[model samples]
Target: MRSAPGEFEIIRDYFADAPIGEGVVLGVGDDCALLQPPAGALLATSVDTLVADRHFPASADPAAIAARALRVNLSDLAAMNAQPLWFTLALTLPHSDAAWLQKFADGLLQTAKAYGVSLVGGDTTCGPLSITIQVTGSSVKPLRRDGARIGDAVYVSGELGAAAAALPVVLGQKLAGEPDRDAAERAYYFPEPQLATAAAIGDIASSALDISDGLLADLGHICAASGVSADIDLHALPVAPLARQLAGERALELAASGGDDYQLCFTVPQEQVATLEKLGLDAVCIGTIVEGQGEVHAWLDGERWFPEAAGYEHF
Candidate 1:
């Protein structure tokens, strides 16, 4: 009888042939990847781990899970106004399933190619199923959390709350029509990284971050880092339509406090607002920075509003 494929054999078969991009000196099959980062550009790197049943449903499609893992990590690069360059995937598998690994690798490499990032190197280990991806990119004039100033305009790229609303459908806890189910799956599995918008606003935005932990919660990070506060107009939010369909009256609250949209939330100084407008980006100003310590205040129809949940907490 044939034995199951070992760790190195699995890597050699499924992940060895990833597309090699410009800066890759040595890619897979080596102990470590040798990369040549672009001169005169700062390197921005971020890592994220998605555990089965926590970040994603354990029984979901392997390909979809792989795509989600890589895409979300790439979102971190976008938030820093970085150009996609390279990434590493550390995969922990309960067992060496050849079919599952092939599907996962296919999804991961396809998404990497689409985003112009190359897979460098990573490790495979035996454990509970989890995927950890670390992405590195080059950035010129990178946006940061501490760059927001009082009087700056707060903005977000694209709509929000769709992914959070899709949770029920994704987990199979709720049934939906075909259209809603497809929309929910798309939002949950294949969130866009907003790299183009981030690049467009890189020079203009004073502060920026990707909204992984709800708009209000992530915006508070910028506030805390910049020693400022924000005043958000609830009516100005561009809530996703899918959120309204799934979450109903709670759509607004979900948009404010639900996580996993992977959209960019940024601040622009008053002087650069005109410049930003000229760029014709798909971004909307939702609020303004105010002189206060790290607090975010929301007003709905001129009345103070608060969300029931702050955001996702790991602990």
Candidate 2:
């Protein structure tokens, strides 16, 4: 009893006169959108998918879901130290709901405007709910996870584990008392991808990756990719006061293995740590890379510590 999405309706309401690129030679309503890049620019493209009951909750507001979908993709670009330029959207929905579409589109437009990116081309299909976004950017140099070197110090931007902490609250697994639940909720819903901060780090950081997974799990990617070992100091990690108070002794558990932080984690030389300190970035020297291999385990109070939970597993 639902209407199938047709190209004509989508064109008139959603795609007609859609803004594409500043240097777009061919925009949408064509076989493919054509773009012309500047001579000195290098193209960086990333694609991400958000499915209902997987990437996000079915009950979440459409505007927030749209913003988060775009933000998560943007976070990937930020990890590579690229400035976002344009994007293409592919949407699958069960039916044409005008109210929901309006909110989703408004959120998408607002997020794109905020990040200086433009919507170029895409398609809409009738199916289960899903959003696929491909964003493109330009960078002279891309920060990769494999550039970490022996003797470089590991650093993380902002506090860790708030997003994971909020998960329990959202699912009714935990009760609200202090600021922990509130902080966690904010981190989970409105993740501020560290684009400008990563750009500031530039070539200074030898290797970098965004912390979408737990700290140890995400850092393990850098370690495995770079063939190095990382030693993290539990005391050195910056845990939010609210989370620490709520978690008590379990603070380390949340910090080590909780996911959805969306912060930048990178490795910098010991000598450059001082320079980075002056930049007003709340970067913490939580660990150091050494001439070894494998994922990072922590040392707290001179005892080997392992978190009970791992990062988010898509399986």
Candidate 3:
């Protein structure tokens, strides 16, 4: 059996080579990371925590855990059309397993490289396994939920609910069988944040949010913030193919209520629809904003449909 390494040894061996650029004066090894901000853009920051049992299976691959923890925060940056510059990680482990740490660092560093972000600084400690990531980004005219108008069209990026569909499989509650099963498990393990397309959409999307929670629930947040109502065409939701195959009759419900999709949901004004289309974003028009209080009227084939569960709950 491999021996557990000490904290500094783990840092030196695993996290010491974190990529640095974009005004990062110091990273990882320093007492505090020093950063120089770029001009002409506003800074955007987001933080996310992933707990072992609540977020992922306790026995999940350490690399997958690290990826999920960081990607979720990056999703927040994508929602605001922000580009990530730097990030810090705080990891708590039951034991300092060197192999696990190495896998985790590989995942973190690779994702950081793909997203053009540097690992600035962080701390490690012993405890129940959990990961927290703080991401720093920049944006010009950050998308705000309150910016939607009554005439705006609501849209979403990518297909939804595959990750949620894999939950039963992840927990081993369902027997793994089928092509869809593999697809769903892949989505659950490595959810791709819509960072690239988000930048492409840019200010064309007036109000935007990442669908970390279920589509309906996260859309409701936008409605509440904008003090507007919406008419969501349930059939228009771009449900993932695997989600439909796996969920069967519950596909729509899962798409509306299943969290962790991490797709971008946004609205564009009637006048700006052409501009948004010109950007060639992989988004679908799912609903329309209207003149009313924050009431979301979900419709399916000309009739209203409401589900029992809304989405994942923080409390």
**Candidate number with greatest TM-score:** 1
lDDT for residue 229 in candidate 1, whole number 0-100: 98
Residue ranges of candidate 3 with Cα displaced over 4 Å? 1-10, 176-181
Q: How many residue pairs clash in each candidate?
A: 0, 0, 0
Q: Write the per-residue lDDT of candidate 3 for residues 1-315, one digit (tens) a residue.
A: 443432343566697677787798866665677899999999999888889898888888787788888888988998888888999888888987888889989988888888789988887778899888999999987888898889899999999878888778767785535545556567887788888878877768779999988988898889999999889999899988778777777878888878888999999999999988887778999999998887788998899888788766789
Clashes of 2: 0
- Cα RMSDs of all predictions? 2.9, 3.0, 3.3
Tens-digit lDDT track of model 2 for 252-306: 6787788777889999988888788888887888989988786686888888788
The C-alpha lDDT values of all candidates are: 0.91, 0.81, 0.84
Model 3 scores worst on lDDT over the 10 consecutive residues at: 1-10
lDDT of 1 by residue, 1-315 (tens): 333322344576797668899989988766678999899999999999999999998889999999999999999999999998999888888998988999998999899889989988887888899998999999997999999999999999999999999989898884545547788999999999999999999889999999999999999999999999999999999999999999888889989999999999999999999999999999999999999999999999999898998988989
Candidate 2, which segments miss by more than 4 Å at Cα? Answer: 1-21, 172-184, 245-249
The TM-score of predicted model 2 comes to 0.90
- State, as a TM-score between 0 and 1, how close model 3 is to the true structure: 0.94
| Model 1 lDDT, residue 199, Cα | 91
What's model 2's lDDT at 100? 87
